[model samples]
Target: MSPEMTRKIFLYGAGGHAKVILELLEVNERRCAGIYDEYGAATQLLGYPVSGNLNDDYKAADSAMIIAVGNNAVRRKLARKLSANWATVIHPSANISSRCTIGNGTVVMAGVSVNSEVRIGDHVIINTNCSVDHDCVLANYVHISPNVALAGNVQVGEGTHVGIGATIIQGIKIGKWATIGAGSVIIRDVPDYAVVVGNPGRILRMNEPEDVAGK
Candidate 1:
């Protein structure tokens, strides 16, 4: 591994998302000095010590960090608090076009494809097997779940969760904190905090508890 690959760092979460990031750290040959989670009292993750607080010591020990929280809002909030340099994590197997601009603290998981002119904002999660086509703009803290397909020029707002197998048509705009239900086909613009579901994705609720998978 190159020296860059072995750079020391801390993780800012200890949930399921953090576990996946741990695997990535190992693959890149990076050393994880510790993990900090306000909710995690556990001592270790994959044998790395878990530090409870986001201390000055932890922040000063490393120059890089990955926000491994699944909830986009929480991740963004903590990221601002840490204020460390954001590290983008792209799996080696992912195919991202040269024209794509991925902002810091983003993770492009395996089998994901980001086409030309795609602008991915900070702390976003583009999970496995997702396809983001040309001219798409994903704002900060957006989570595109596995098997989701975003057609061209789709604008996803901040902290939105596009659930598994969701299909967003071209030129559609999804608003901030909106929940796109699993297997829904969104053919139109969705308003902020709307929970839309079903074929063609009609608005089911507004400003509701996000877990549209249960709806």
Candidate 2:
């Protein structure tokens, strides 16, 4: 469909990430119906009304929604609770190849470069200034933070978060829910729930139940 025909969207968060998503929607000429943030008491956000909590029924039948939360797990959980009418917002400045397949509820932010044959799954966030190389596979709810670089053939599993400025070498397979720390250089495969850090990325620890409790 033409950019002019983009549908109205409702955002599920009202913080900093939602603000960026709002700008993305604006660049594409899409309108936001409102925002839903359970913790926020503000009556409006970026000129749009702050609606009720996310669980409150969405009134507009034609409107789509996106989980604007930056946390990968929260976004994934919220997405599962909502209807299938999810919006994919791509900033006008992003360079996404026509050969790439982007799934619903994904957001491609400004200055991002997605190369040919990349497969981005549902509710993924390809954050600002990131570069995803050809043939990369990003599974559902993955968040590639700002300036992260993934070489060709890299595979990132569901709910993984590659922190800002991290670089993943070619053909590396990052397992589900892994966290690659900011500025780390990933040269090897990572297992599920592993948290890696440092210039040459090393597994710091697995994400245990206690670790999640602290967050």
Structure candidate 2, residue pairs in collision? none
TM-score of each: 0.90, 0.92
Residue 194, candidate 1: how far off, in angstroms?
Answer: 0.8
Cα-based lDDT for every prediction: 0.85, 0.87
lDDT of 1 at 200: 84
Q: Tell me the deviation in Å of residue 20 in model 1.
A: 0.8
Residue-level lDDT of model 2, residues 1-215, one tens digit each, is: 86424666789988899989988888887878778988777677788788665653443556788898898888877776676488888888899999999999999999999999999999999999999999999999899999999999999998899999999999999998889999999999999899999979999999873343223
In candidate 1, which residue pairs clash? none
Off by over 4 Å in 1: 1-6, 208-215
Instruction: Report the alpha-carbon TM-score of model 2 versus the true structure.
Output: 0.92
After aligning candidate 1 to the native by TM-score, how far in Å is the CA of 101 from where it should be? 0.5
| Residue 180 local lDDT, model 1 | 95
